[model samples]
Target chain A: MRDTIARCETTAHAEGLAAGLTQALAAARDGFSPPGRVAALPADRVPPGAAAVRNRLAEREGIGCFVWPGREAERPHHVRPGHETERPHHDGASDDTTTEFAVLLGAVRLGATRRLLEHAVTHLSGRTVGGEPTLRKQLVLGTVADVMTGVEAARHALLTGASVPDAVADTHERLTELDWETTKLLGASGYLADGPARTAHVSRLLADCWVAAPGGTP
Target chain B: MTELDAPLRELRGMCREAARDLRTRALAVDADPADVERHLDSPTLTLIRVASTPKRFRADGSVDDGGYSGSCLARVIAGVELARGDAGLICANTGPSLAGVAVDALGSEAQQEAFYDAIADGRTWTFFGMTEPDRGSDATAMETRLEAAPDPADGMLLTGAKRYVGNASRGRIGVVFARTGRTALSVRGAVVRIPAAGYEATPLDMIGLRGARICAIDLNGVRVPREDVLGAHLPASRRGLWGIGRTFNVMRTQIASMALGVALAARDLVREERPGWSGHERVSARLDAALALLHDAAVQVDHDPDARRPPSVAKLHITDLAVRTTRWAAHALGPGAMLEHPLLEKWCRDVAAFEFMDGTSNIQRLHITHDVATRATAPRPSAGRVTTPTADRVTAPQGAA
Candidate 1:
């Protein structure tokens, strides 16, 4: 789980890692009972008392994410990344199906990109931070990074002709790298470092990513 | 003498005398008839003397040193006089009077004396005609025009309309901004005093602050003398947008102070009338917070009148707080407060006007974001307050102002 989380390149991958870690922590707090132990017991063998105990343990671990020291071994399990991760594939698939997945991925990425640019206009028009102005700016900048990554992954999937699910999965993997770059820039500058220079940067990057995909057509 | 010390001292002495005279008159309203008569007779002239003395004496006074320039002192004196007499209309009439002070600060020495002398002697009420009907936040985008030729008789033909000019209706002089060259972006301002016949002002009936007579001044080929061109001596490349940005800082601070006065007035009234109200505890807490905020803002404003971002933030916070605090006061006071009680409703109205005065909160925030996005680091708190070093502490970014 730690290795998988460490390898996460996109927001979707990071999110999947986070969800898996959450489940593992939950099971560990339930006293490491065998999977079928409770089923083998009498109807009420694993009493509500055990369930409450497990609930408290989970709560404690959740709280630890914020309060635990950096040196603590358990800290990493609870520390959620600021950026979202890409979605993972549920089944193995051949390469030929990947191209079909790219279309769906492209639509979603394009929609997000459009929304982000629209938000920048509203945000820049106003002077205040917390109001409609700040919200718009944040949305625009935040989604630009996310959409750029998704487009890159979609292009790779389209070229490879993987199954729809495999294509999405591959796209998600490519997105993780872009997401890291975006977060780094955001942390360095209080605003999006590149998007402000020009409105077309996001679109151009996405277009290039699509054209570079294995498929002959964008 | 430091550039401003001598003049500041002289101005302080004048203002002290003026304040004392006003206090004396205020206290003697129901006292001895002779005392009241004497107080009434001398108050106007005495206050005017006090206000104008800052300009005349040009010596540093501790209380009012920042605003006391040769002509600014004169306008402050005029404002103090107008304020003391409770003449809202005359006080409102003083917007253009104050604009002359700004002209003195940014304009040339000749321009300064011309506008200042007129304002000081009560010969002219000059409007700083910058804000246009279509261009509220965008002063540089003003559509007004001033075509210049080589003729000394008609130095420049000013043909543009200035809206919401305070003293426009009765102004003897106008410090107007117009597109002097071909470029709409090439806007330049001049101090032009024309015969009343040359320019016409249509009075604008505003909702509140009825005392200030705001008008729309229309200029049709109103000729301006070459000497009247403010900052004309400076190269356009040098003057640039920095002049307007600098002037906005001063204007915003003054406006904030006015709003602060209104807030103080509202808070005082609520405290006096609602000694045992239900939400007195909550109101007290809010008032305490509001006062703290106001004090922080005022200190920053006084320390550095030119720090654009802090004051913009201060103005937005203070005015919004003023409006909210006044509303709370009105609600807590109930029906009695709502009635023709001079304190409650009048203050609410005054503060409301302030909220929209300089630029709306939206406009202020937009400026703040633009500054912040472009700014490498937050500005130091007006170069006065000591900021302790931290790891993430980036040095203050130097802005245009």
Candidate 2:
């Protein structure tokens, strides 16, 4: 009786694996843009067009593909991917996905910067310092430059697609530094507004960007 | 200041005095900042004491034709004045006045008379309970259920829990909204005496607005008589959650006025703390813009009671400004601002509540955006007819002030 039950369980497992593989292969073949569609391959049996497939998965799954490394003694189990992974897939995110996230982060930063700048202009206009638009102009220009640099970095990284370039990595660091400078320039107002008062609205942008970056994403 | 008419000038004078007295009382209170009695006794309640009387309620359940004193504009001025003293105090008193406004808007002649008669002494507190435990900005999606009793003449049985009910525990009268059926659109409203059997109200501890006894109410088969069900004969669209749109046309402006007052208070505090603070062009400009936004909305509301967009825009802008201004003020006073001046932090926390209290800021923007889109897509008037923009078309002043 126990042997029969074990046989039935093994059969069910094999059937389920077959069904999942069939669905995943079909998704990969048709380029599944919707979530929850992922295909797995043995580490030793990686396909020839692995890079292209990884990029496609990153674009569709947002966080990128999974590549589970097999243990020395144990055979790998075929686990299916859901709409969202429990953790960042066991493997790293593609450079393309990182670049995409950087662009999104850049947009959020720019939006927040513009909101504060507009506020500054309105507030300063009525003060004694109202005579000079120089400081405000300079800050605005600096922010615009930061946005442009971020966009350029993202475009380059996306075009490259595979390994993260040194410039792209540096650009992400620079953006984080720029965020610090922004908070300082706006002074305590920016710090409080982004931290406690507005529920970390400005800080959340940076945090989200970090989540999509190299070390954090995987 | 612009030239004011005689009646408006008089009304403003009364409000100014009330505001001055209220501020004086608030400032006199000792280090125990959470003193609810001080807030209750604060002259901010002068607006409520004077405005909640039977004389203010006409025979037909409408406001008396007593010039600006009987108009929403008067309440707007009073709200601004009360808020200047303390936003918490304004929040506490605002609930009672809102209840009065709801009664005037939807109550029958006897209902209004009963409410006014009960509150004639000026100490009686009234409240409105629409938001439930599960509902926030989308209060229309309430879970509080109302069912018909066995006898059609016996009224409905209400069973549900309401959260964030301002003044619920302390107040005698309440305007409560409950879902009548399983459908999303089946929400209805009824007025009831809260201390009645099966009705339980527990005061909630809050981060700010301490003066306001925000409560959680559990209505376990609370009976709501047929006559007390607001707009019962009216269709679903004209009553309960749906009908609040009409009520908000007036209430939004009052809320804007309160927010404006808080912003003004924050501005004054910052300017006083750092004498050189106003020298910053950014600070000055921001204050001016905020004031301009408030004035624009006030003008629109004063001209036409039914004007929608201006009040919402004002409410949205002023609430944001109030929060921003308070935070800015605290930071301007150096690192120990929170410790040195507790009022700044208190005001900041209190003003933050306004964003979610009336309706979330996102909800306000959504309504405004939808209204703008709807108007834009609406067919233009017949050819050869010239139509003026809403801002330009000035009708007879509302509130008869």
Candidate 3:
């Protein structure tokens, strides 16, 4: 688990969020178990590009289930979480979200979140707005620093077991926030439909399905 | 709480009533952006079109609710109500919008008439292009240029590209800011009409607010006549940058109000979908406060046309609040609620549109912080407290040294 997180983070830091998320999505397949929610498993488990992952829900034709390759017998499929096109579960389907899946979702997105932060730093450093490099603005610098602080704290929490019961879910929520703050640095361009912000948005949606409420049962 | 005068209250009520039709068309527009064309005849959209146009240009005559274009307060009242039905659809609707505000500020009698006449068809869309491919919202750094034609009779030629522009592809007539020289004063707005040579627009596939059809435009030597240049009669001081500031101040409040409306819509969706959910009261309370802030900002702008911080602060705070509210609505509806409720998911996407509409939150922060610094640097004369070179203290606690 540590090696996977390390590898994904390293790859993301070296490359970008797309490459990092690609690595993270790959790790999502084998080790995690969703409690009957929209499992955003890659098509045929080939792990498509980050853009493909971001547009996964859009591409789907209202079929909100992913069938794992080897587990077709015991668990035929897992429904997608509270999607706009989601179908109601049968009377017997479970609603309890597993903490293990939330933890894994946190790990998968952690590297990508860091990579997004890196991009923000690089962007803020090179650009100037209103006669100053936005990085020199106290507000912009503060937000970037805050995001970095969150990435470090989340990394630390993942390395050593957290004392909080739902630490992973909390981490996921914080990362989502930090990710948004980082995206803010890109100004209007960041909000583009196909921009890096959508990757974080897709990650948040993925987290929403798997991460249970902080006090909820595992 | 905001205390609205009777006329404003009536305006809000009428807008609220018109919002129902807007809601009906919101989903359809989301499904297919081109669907907006089919609904051009919708009573609500028609009323919006007339309301947005200036008084002299309104071929449809005076609206009973007065009009939304006369004041920032009026725009906020109408904007919030109209946007509650669907902010995305408001962007989808073909009307004067920001361009009208710009013309109202900078255009001469003939220019305004020319501008209004172009969009009188109701079907024709209008666009305002300022953000450049590399410059974003830094209007002063605009690279789009207006250079002298080989023959002066042909006037100047416009060349450069703009990205993230609304109605870029659909607009038949619009305004694009371009620099004729290197200085800030050199930047100018030229009234542009399309189907003209050297103008190309391509719609971008936006993840949300598809109805707005945010697009990229490439202007390769588009023709601009001498009279078509905005602020031609005005001195250089009241030209491009001045109009941009005043226009942005008004648009910011409207954008912020629309964002509040979207948040209200998101919260209401939770109430409708999860009927028994008592967890949304907090959301409702926050929205109420945001409405007040939006109204206050509008009132400030109406009183002081050049006021920047109020509108900037309102936009910066409300845009983030609206986006958060949508997420709150999504979570309140339980897991996969977005799948079960299409409107909620669409609101989630639509709310982000407001942040980039006029000025981004970062730009707003700059205006706000600069205002704060100015206030701090100049201590109030009526205050009684210690003042230092680095800080200003108006009031301190009882035990303060």
Q: Which candidate is the best by DockQ?
A: 3
Ten consecutive residues with minimal summed lDDT in candidate 2 chain B?
B392-401
- Considering only the true interface residues, what is the Cα RMSD of candidate 3 after superposition? 5.3
Model 2 lDDT, residue B199, Cα: 91
True-vs-predicted CA distance for residue A70, candidate 1, Å? 74
State which candidate, 1 or 2, has the greater DockQ: 2
All models, DockQ values?
A: 0.01, 0.02, 0.25
Candidate numbers, best lDDT first, in rank order? 3, 2, 1
True-vs-predicted CA distance for residue A30, candidate 3, Å: 9.0
**Tens-digit lDDT track for model 3 on B1-401?**
56988888888888888888889988788878866788888888888998888777887774554435478888999999988988878888898987888888889999999999989888989988888777787877888999999999999999999988888898988888899987767778888998889999998867678788788999999999989999988777667676678788898998898889899988887777556657788889888988898899888888877777889889999999998898777666554445446677788878887887777787787677764676667748676776544322122112222
Q: What is the CAPRI rating of model 1's predicted complex?
A: incorrect
For all candidates in order, the CA lDDT equals 0.44, 0.52, 0.73
* True-structure Cα RMSD, model 2: 19.6
| lDDT by residue for model 3 (A1-218), tens | 67776766776557544455456666654444443233443344433331122233333311122322333333211222334345334211132224433544566678668767777778777887767886898878888878878888988776564334367656876887788778777766666656666666666666655554443311
Fill in the DockQ of model 3. 0.25
**Residue B110 in model 3: shift from native, Å?**
1.5
What would the per-residue lDDT of candidate 1 be over residues B1-401, giving only the tens digit for each residue?
01324655565455544543443333123122122223323544334433433354322232343344433222333333233232233333322345654574467777666665665543345677776654544554676887875576668878878776665766677677787764433566777775744688876644334444556778887887778766676656424345556566556555554565455555555666645444456655654554444444434434554456655765677667666666555434431232224434445444555555566665567555664554547665776777553322112223322
Give me the runs in candidate 1 sitting further than 4 Å from their true place.
Answer: A1-218, B1-54, B57-90, B93-96, B149-152, B182-185, B235-240, B275-306, B375-401
